[model samples]
Each structure stands twice: as structure tokens, then as C-alpha cells.
Target chain A: MPAVTVRDLTRRFGPFLAVDHVSFDVEQGEIFGFLGSNGAGKSTTIRMLCGLLKPSSGTATVGGIDVGRDPEGVKRRIGYMSQRFSLYELLTVEENITFFGGLYGLDDRTLAERRAFALDMAGLKGRERTLTRDLAGGWRQRLALGCAILHEPRILFLDEPTGGVDPVSRRQFWLLINRLSESGVTVFVTTHYLDEAEHCHRLALMHSGRIAALGTVSELKNVFAKRAVVEVRTASPMEAVRALDDLPSVEKTSLFGTALHVWLRPGQRATEPLRERLDGLGIHAESLEFVQPSLEDVFMDVVERAGGTAA
Target chain B: MRRLLFLIRKEFQELRRNPRMFPVIFVAPVVQLAILGYAATTDVKNVPIVVVDADRSPVSRDLIGKFEGSPYFSVVDVTSNDGDVQREIESRRAWMALTIPPGYGDAIRNRRPVTVQIVADGSDSNSAGVGLAYASSLIAEKAAEIALQRRPPGAPTIGSIEARIRVWFNPQLLSQHFMVPGVLALLLMVITTVLGAMSVVREKELGTLEQLNVTPLKRWELTVGKLLPFGVIGIIDVLLVVAVAVLWFEIPLRGSFPLLFGLSLVYLLCTLGLGLFVSTISQSQQQAMMTAVFFFMFPMIYLSGFIFPIENMPAPIRPFTYLIPLRYYLVIVRGIFLKGVGLEAFWKDALLMLGWGVGVLMLATFRSKKTLG
Candidate 1:
């Protein structure tokens, strides 16, 4: 059974379609990754599912609860952490958790249990008495993640949860998400970090107003059908981009500082002939390591194809 | 009901958790009360003035001595030339200058009509008027005394001809005594209204309020929760200000303390409710503060019979003054403190405050819901 289901969900701010015909589903206890370009309707969709916003049209059900018919129950079943930091900065970690617990309608006994569980999970047991403002960014993010799931909510919605956290904290936050998913909590999250999508059980790439691609990491790479990513380091970055734009089997190309990452067609072997071609032009390219297409490459391929994917 | 409890509990937690803002919430009103109550006064005495007595005669000297003898005037400078008097008035060294022409004393002794030029600064009308009246009344009393001394025996005295006027309630008309009680009412408003005005705006800025809203908390629960903490602070501020009034200003609280507290609690509900109402509409704390200042500060101070005498206002404005809560509060405070009158004269004030409380609270709750919606 699906833990979350959204159908033909349309949300608008006046005439601007924030989320247009957005539809998706989260399998029970699955880590569903919602991917989108900025302003591509990810948070708007999450808000509708969580009952924070009433959709302009269509329907949503979370944990078998309808967003339209049973908003209050939907609120009780799901937890939301907004893109902007939402914890009480002035309150200490323990107090913040307890306050949220109270709002979630957990009894005092359950509240204590959840507090202890959350504190231990976040690895901030002794620092529970510390005010959230006093905590560093990483700890605060971890604490916020802890607070979001303290009620053991059936489904958790994280809106760009790791936008500004250090990489190490992001790792810990994902670890907690994985733990919760294993414990039967459905995790629906939106993030701009392409690499983070690799950790997701499945990814949905939304662009313009709808999902352009939806599949597992391997499936997404397969959909892109790219054999490998090869770095072309040349004297001039733009020269490589100009050279690769017309290159055969060049699935997608983007600049990373002075290096060029080329996405070649699937099963197209990386041969010395490519270097020979560059050498003939006197390009004197640096190391060309044939790497597998990461979610970054896959995301680019999907977003680029989004222009043509509407049909 | 359960969600309301949750919201209320959350509000209380936020209020407690924010240790830094706690002082602003609880202590600021008391401090403002203490400072404003003491500094805000209407009594005018010892107005410094330069006396330019050009007439170098015994009567001119005696008239200047009489001014120095009066408590209302402290003759700072005794100048002989007319230009010196202008200089004194120009420099603000004297709010007023009394000029006696060269022939003034000669004319008074010869029974010729004498004129003494009395000039006063008109900048600050209240204290200026007070000073002018005090000085002029004293001189008129002296004029009457002289007239009596010169009157033929068995003739009717002007004092007997004019009935003696008595001022009730405030006999001496000590501005401090009158203003201090009004100051207490004003202080209560500052605490209660400001607290309410900041509450919703704080929640919006803080983001915790969004959390509460997403929960199952009903509108009434949210309203009550947001109001309770500030309401408590308002009551505490009332007690603190009244204590200062009773002790420091010696302004008696002859009315029942419990009555004042109970009424203040109702008044605070309206005030704090208004604060929440302001918060709901305002996008930021700065806007909320400014809006509260403009709306509450002026009305409470000017229209509330706080700084001005309500009865003395124009007849049209007089009816409008009846709508200001402070008018009723002043009556209640004075009736209790000065007149030692209790509920007999105050039940009307109590009902007015109660109606305002319920009416404002309902509007606030409805508006808060609409804003969120």
C-alpha cells in the first residue's frame, strides 16, 4: 500500500501555477526523493500533501487519510520541516521537542519517551538543555530533523532539509532518515542537491509544472542511457564546451571550474581516439577518467529533456 | 479544546523559553510606568521670571518684593532697563517678565490709573497657563487687599458681593494628585495594549506560530493562548504601577484592590487581544510596534481623558470621550482612591470595560482566523 498519494494536484498563487498537474505516490515506508529546479513546485506540492495549503484542484491522501476530506487527520499523521529553519531558536532542544510533542498531541509519557528517543538518535543527549540558538548549524539541523519525527509520524515531509548544512551533518541527517524509513516511517523529501538524490530510494524530477522523470537511481541513469562521464581538462574551459557540443555520443556537457564533464552514449567505449582527436587540434587535454554517470549527470539529462518530455 | 490547550501550552513555553524577550515583555512596562508616572506632572510652581522695575520708587520696590514673596514666582533677575527684560525673555531665562514703567508707582500713589506690563511665554500652554494664572491671581488678591484698605467704612466688600467658589473632588487642584492617578491608568494601557500588539507579530516572526496553526488548534484556543501570557503580565504591571503610585506618589488606592485587579484583568484581555489583532495583520515586529504606537498610544493618551480633562473638552468631543476606556478607568481610579467610593459608582465602569474586553477579543479572534485563511 502506498503511504502517500497525490493526484492531479494543482496549486496556484493567483495566475501563477506553483504546482500544475503534479501527481506522485510514496510506497509504504519508502524514502521518496522529490527533485526540482528552483521554483519548480516541490514545496508547494509538499504543503498540499501536509494540509498546510488547500490545493486549487485534485486530491491527496497521506497514510490513507484524504487531504481534502480529513485535513485534521492528515496533520496528525504527517510532520513537516520547512525549507526555512522552523525550530524555536530561543527554546532549548529538550523544551523545543517537548513543545512540539505537545502540539502533536502526544501524552506526557509518550512525549518523554519520544524526547529520549530523538535526543539519542541525534547524538545530542547531554546537549538537550542547550538552547537551539547556541547550537551550531549542523547540530541545529540534526535537532530539527529529530523534532520533525519525534511523534514517530507515519510520514515525514522534509522541504530542502539540508540546504545550508555542512556535508558531515547532511550525512547524519540522511542516516536518521534511513533509520526512520527502516522503522516504517515514509520519508518524502525535496532537495536541490543532485548528489543527495543518490541516497533516495527513488527520485522524481519536477520541472516547469510537472514531473519530467521518476525512477530509481539506476533507472534514472538508464533512462539517460549514458555509458560514462569523462572529464576533459583543457587549457580553456569554454574551448572544451565548444568542442564537445558537436561531439558524437555527447549526452550532456557542463563546466566544473576549468574541467568539462562529458556524458557519452551508453556502451560507447571510451577510446584513445577521443584524446587523439583533441591532440590533433593541439588541445593537450589532461587526465580523462571514465566515470559512471552520477545522479548529477542523470538530473541534467532529465531537466534538459524536460523541454521535450511534456508530451 | 485539546488543541487550544496545546496552543496555550506552546505559547507559555515560547514566553518562558525566550529569556531575552522576557524582560522586554514584563519589565519594560514597569520601568516605563515608574519613569513616566514620576516625570509626568501638571503642577506649575516657582516659574523663573525676570522683573524689569524701571520705576526707582518705594512702591515699585514693594511690588517686586511681593512677587519674590509669592511661591509661584522666583524672581531670577531684577533688571532696571527695558532691553534687559527683552534679553531675559529671548534667552528663556525668564518665561515671563514684569515691567513697571517709570511713572507706575507715582501714578498709583496719586490715584491715577497704573498699568504693569505682564508678559509670558506661550510655548508650553499647560504649565505656561498654570504659571500665568498663579502669578496673575496673586496680584489680583493684592489688588483686592489694597482696595479693601482704601474702602469707606460700612461699604459692601467685593468679596461679600461675589459668592466664594469652591472646587470639589480636587480642592487644591494639585496637578500631581490629579495626574498621578491618570498616569496609573495610562501605565496599565501601555503594558496591556503593547503586550497584545506584539504577541501575534512575535509569533509570525518566530515561526513557531505557524507550527501551532498547522496543528489541530482551534481559533479560540489560539486566541486564548496568545492572550493569557500578556494578560498575566498586564495584571502584574497594574499591581506594580499601583504599588508605586500608592507608595512613591502617595496616591491612595481607596478602592478595593481586588476590584481593580479583576477589572484590569478584563481590560487586559481587550488590550492583549488588540495586540494579537495587530500582530495578525502586521508582517514584521517593527510594523507591529509602529502600528500599536499609532493606534493605542494616541487614543489612550489623548482621547482617553488621560492627559486632557474629558468634561472640559468641546461638547461634541465630550460625547466621543465617553467611548475611550481610560475615561471610565479614571473615574474608577479616582472614585476609589480620592472619593473612597466602591462598586456603587464603579459597576458602570466595570461593565464598560467588560463589554470592551469581550468585543475586542471576539474581533481579534475572527480577524486572526481571517488573516491565516
Candidate 2:
């Protein structure tokens, strides 16, 4: 059976529909990413799946237990962590581990074994005596992850778990997550970081309380398979975008950092026309090259297509 | 139950690491007891009095001597000028002024009735009222003595009625004895209620509460674990403040020790439940503290008969005092400490307290369950 399954899950806060008719499923041991901008219902959906919140309608099951019917059973079978890395700051690393282990009702022998495993996994063996508040953000984040998994559940839900960590620590944290997924632990994660979302086996992009797109990275990039995306870099990106926007072959134009990404119509080539247009407008084109569509480009296109403002 | 232990242990560990909590738990109670115990007294003693003896006679001097000799009144000034009496009272140098009129000695020799004026500073109403009563009783005693002496030997003596009044529980009417026990109840309420609310709200602020909600721990387990530690702390504070009251302030503990402790536990249920209820409504520790103090603690202190007697409170507001848990606790603690009364004397109050305790706890539990869900 799939580790998690949701069908038409909906959550409403009074008049605001936070998660609207969301449906998805995650196979066991797969890394499923939920990506969205702020206030896009990613966290709300994750909360519902973890049984922390009751859905306003529809059904969800985690580890074969219906979340709305037996939330306690679901809780016992899954581990959850959040962006805040909610470890007790005043407690020492070892004390936090022991406390979480005891909270999971682990036997003393199992607690001891799990405690050692958590310490080793967090690379906190020598620093167990340090208070959690004294640790840097990276260590604290890892410690929080370790505490969440002390019961050795098969499914883990992480909500923007690496929000504020340094790049090096974020990479290290992802390594641990990948290792967990390889050990037959299903990982369900939500993040706004497009670069990190690349690590998921499959991803669902949410927008305005609804899933805008769901697929593998290459499959998502296939929206541009028949068309070409030309990068235009110049002194004035806005002027270049305006000049390229008037061309008959160009479907749409978007700014990507200092460059402009110009989408061409299917079966149409605009490289020569774009250079001639920029030269005719007297706008210097430093570099104009066709490039592969990045996830960020796909995100913008999908959100714009969904008739909502892209965050 | 085992999960509850872990949560409680975690709470204590956090408290131990907090440097600010030490003073609040240990030092603050002692300091408050020392300061408020002495400052909160209503016993009137050494009430300074200015005497204006316009009679300038031996009889007026004798009456002045009577006032000088009383422990309750101190003769601050004795002058023939009547104006000095008002000045002394207005300046707050004396709480009372006694003015004896001219011919007071001749009138007394001839057995003629005369009036003497007594002016008192009523700004401090408690001391002034007590001082006036003392002066009136002293003059009455002197008048009785003079009438007895002037009566001819075996001349038809008139029988006079006398009242033999004895104050029970507190023989000397020391306000400290009454106030110290109430302070114990007040301290327990303040500490347990405020700290309990802050502890839970702190978790909410830190986002740890949301994390815990996802765990397999039951709701009752969470509530019990969160409040039981504060309850234990409340008991310890009861022991500490009671020791200070009995040993340091010399207030008697006339009832059973176990009864006081057990009753304190019941009172703690109400306070801790209030804390839990406050936590449910507050989003941060500051909000929780404000709600506990301004909304709960202040009202309870004012209406609980801790400082003011319930009998003297406005009738419409008296019923509201029934809602304050500290009200019943003050009665119970004072009964145990002063009256040496057992449950028989205050079983009704104990039952009321139990009702309030259970009702509040159930309300708080229901609120917290809904909030968590």
C-alpha cells in the first residue's frame, strides 16, 4: 500500500479555503516534495496529512490509518518536523533525545538504543552536554530531526525543514534525508526553495490553495519541449523584453535575474529575428542563447497559467 | 503515565536552566512575605495625641496623665492653647487631640456634667477609629471610678451593667495573624497561576506546542504533565510561606499540618486550571502573564477577603467573590491557622472549593482540547 493517500482533502478556516480539493498519493520510501509560495496551502496540506489538523472535507490515510478517524494511530506511525526545529532550547542535547524517546513510549532498552542512534546520526556525540540553545542553527536543526525520528516510524513529514540554515548545512541535512529514504522511510517534504525541490522523486507545485502541476522535473520541463526559451542579457533588460515582446514568433517574455527569457511559438525559431530586432532597436545584446527551462521558469509559467499572481 | 513523567521532567529541566525563574520561585515569596507581612498590619498602636488643657487645674492634669499612661496613646504635646490641637492634627503629627474646658476641676468637685472636645484625623480611618474607641473607653473607666469614689458610704448604690468581652482566635487582634495566612493563599495563587500559564504559553510561542500535538501523547497526558509540576511548586511554596508565617511572624498553626497541605492541593487545582485556561486564550508568554495578573489575580486579591473583609464588601459584589478560588482558600487557611478548626468548621467551604476546582479544571481541559484539536 502507498504510505500516504489523500483524495479531495479540503481545509477551511471560516471563509478562507486553505487547502482546496487536494488529492495525491505517495509510494513507500519515495521522496515526495510539495512546493509552493507562502500562503499557498503547502503547510496546511502537510498538517492535515500528519493529522495535526482535521480536514474540512474529504479523506486521507497515513500508514493505513485514516487521519480524521484515528489521528492518534496515525501519529504513532509517523514522524513530523517543521521549519522551526522545535527542540526545547533549555534542554541539553541528550536530555532532548531522552525526553522525546520517552514521549514515544519506547521501552528503556529501545530508548537507550534509539538515543545512541540519534546522537550518532546528529553528529552530536561529543556535544550531548551542550544546551540546545547554545548549538548553532545547523546542529539544532539536525537535533530536531533526530528527536522526531526516535520512534523509528516508516513515514516522515518535514515542513520546510531547512528554512534558515546555511547552504553547507542544508546540503548535509539533505544527505541525511536521502539516507533515510534509502532505508525504506517515506519522506514527505514541503519547501519554497526550487533548488532543493529538485531532489524529490516526484513534486507537486501548489498555487492559491490548489495543485497547479504534479510530475517529475523533466516531465514538468516538457511544457517547453516543442518551444524554445532564449536568454537575452543586455544593459536594459526591460527594453530588451519590450523589443522581444512585439515579435510575432515570441509567445511570452519573463525576467530571470539580469536576463530576459523569451518563449518562442512552437515550430518557430526566433534567434536571427531576436538579434536583428535588438540591433534594429539600438539595444545592446551582451549574450543571447537558447537555454534549458529551469524549475523556477516552469514555476512562473505554471502559476501564471493558473490565473493567479506568482509569489 | 510514563509520558507524563517525561513531560514533567522536561518542564523542571527548563525551569532549572532559567536564571530568572530562581528568584521568582524562591526569593520573591520570601521578600514579599517579609515586606507585606509587616506593612499590611491594621493594629493601631502608639497613636499620638495632642492635649489642650485650658482648665489649668489639677483635675485636667490628672486626665492628661491618664492619657499619657496608656500604651495605646502617646502624649505628644500638652499645651494650654486650644489652637495647637488643630495644628497638630492637620499636620498629621497626632491622630487625635483632647481639649479639656475651663472649670473642669470645679465642675468635677461639685459633680456637674461637662463636655470635652476630641478632634481626630480621619484621613487614616482605621487608626483614627481605633484610637477614638480607645479614648472613649478610657474616659468612661475614669468616670466610673470617680463616681464610685464620690458616693457616700452605704448610700443606696446603683447597679451598673458590665460586658465581659473576649476576642477568640486572635486574642490581641493582631492583624498580622489574620493577614499572614491569607498571604499564604495569595502567594500560592499568584505563583501557580502565573507560572503555569506562562509555561504553556511559552511552548506555544516557541512553536513547540504544535510539535508536541503531532506526537502520540494524549490530551489529558499533556494537560496533566503541563500543570502537575506547577502544582508541586505550589505545594512547596505553601510549605515555605507557612514556615515563615509560623516561625518568623509567630503566627500560630493551630490545625493539622496534613489538612492544610491537602486543602492547599485542592486550591492548586483551581489556580492551575486558571493557568491552563489562560494559556488557551493567550498566544505568548507576555499575553498570558498580563491576562493572569490583570484579569484573574487582581480581581481575586481584591474580592477574596484577603485584605478587606467580605462582610464589609458591597452586597452586590459579594456573590462574585464566590467565584474567586482564593476566597474559600482564605477562609480555610485562616480557619486552620487561627481557629484551630478541623474540616467540621469549614467542610462547607472545602466542598465549595472542590466544586470550583473541579469545574474550572473541566472547563480548562475542554478548552485546551478544542484548541489542540
CA shift of B266, model 1, Å: 1.9
CA deviation > 4 Å runs, candidate 1: A226-237, A247-252, A256-259, A263-273, A287-291, A308-311, B1-27, B49-65, B77-84, B97-117, B150-160, B310-331, B339-352, B369-373
Model 2 alpha-carbon drift over 4 Å, by segment: B153-157, B370-373
A-chain TM-score per prediction? Answer: 0.91, 0.99
Residue-level lDDT of model 2, residues B69-159, one tens digit each, is: 9999999999999888878988888889998999899999999998888888989888889999999998988888889999999898778
Give the TM-score of candidate 2 (chain A).
0.99
Residue-wise C-alpha lDDT for candidate 1, range A75-141, written one tens digit per residue: 7777778766688887788878887787777888998999998798878999888988888888887
Give the CA lDDT, 0 to 100, for residue B323 in model 2: 92
Clashing pairs in 1: B196-B275, B197-B275
Task: Note the DockQ of each predicted structure.
Answer: 0.37, 0.70
Instruction: Report the number of the highest-DockQ candidate.
Output: 2
What does candidate 1's lDDT look like per residue over B115-191, in tens digits? 78888888877767888887777677766766777778998876545447798666777666677777777777766
Candidate 1 lDDT: 0.77
Q: After superposition, how far is residue B133 of candidate 2 from its true place, in Å?
A: 0.2
